[model samples]
Target: MNKDQVKGVGEQIKGKVNETVGKATNNPGKELKGDLQQAAGKVQKAYGDAKEAAKDNAKHKAP
Candidate 1:
């Protein structure tokens, strides 16, 4: 996977951990931040997926 994909996945995992911790500690702010981070990570991963798909399509179309 590319950097974006890797970073995105990492962020998602980190966010999940933070969310779980926040919930356990009764911290709404931390939970909200984790939710935001997870959302960003999903977007970034989608972008990376699109890039990879485009690259593959281009290769297949090459003469």
Candidate 2:
């Protein structure tokens, strides 16, 4: 996995924790921040996936 993939996964987990904590404590700001972080993580993860696919394709095409 690329750095983005790893970091994205980590951020997703952290976001989940923050979201839960925010909901439990009734903190809207934390909840919003968590939501944003989760979205960012998803994007980063997707980017990493695409990058890996491209790399794999390139390797396979090499003679």
Candidate 3:
């Protein structure tokens, strides 16, 4: 996977941890922050996926 995909997955994992911890500790702010991080990660991963798809398309289309 590209750096963006890898980083996005990492961020998602980290966010999951934070979200779990926040729930355990009853911190709404932390939980919200984790939710945001997860959304960001998802976006990054999607972008990376699109990038790879475009790269592959270009390679296949080349003469």
Candidate 4:
């Protein structure tokens, strides 16, 4: 996986932990922040996925 993919996954895991902790602690703010972090991580992971797909397509199309 690329840097973005790895980082994204890491962020997602961290976000999930934060969200769970926030929920257990009854902290809405932390929960919201965790949700945002997860969203950002998803976007980053998608971008990395697209990049890898494009690279593969280009390689396959090459002579």
Question: Cα RMSD for candidate 3?
Answer: 0.6
**Candidate number with greatest lDDT:** 4
lDDT of 2 by residue, 1-63 (tens): 899899888888888888888999999999988888898888889889999999999999999
Query: What does the lDDT come to for candidate 1?
Result: 0.90
List lDDT for all candidates, in order.
Answer: 0.90, 0.89, 0.90, 0.91
| lDDT by residue (tens digit), candidate 1, 1-63 | 788899898889888988988999999989988898899899989988988999999999999
Stronger candidate by TM-score (2 vs 4)? 4
RMSD of each: 0.6, 0.7, 0.6, 0.6
Q: Model 2: what TM-score?
A: 0.94
Encode model 3's per-residue lDDT on 1-63: one tens digit a residue: 799999898888888888988999999988988898899999999999999999999999999
Error of 3 at 41 (Å): 0.3
What's the best-to-worst order under lDDT?
4, 3, 1, 2
Question: Where does model 2 exceed 4 Å of error?
Answer: none
TM-score of each model, paired residue for residue: 0.96, 0.94, 0.96, 0.96
Name model 1 segments beyond 4 Å from true: none
Estimate, for each residue in 15-35, the C-alpha lDDT of model 4 and write its tens digit: 898899899999998998899
* Candidate number that wins on lDDT, 1 or 3: 3
Error of 2 at 55 (Å): 0.5
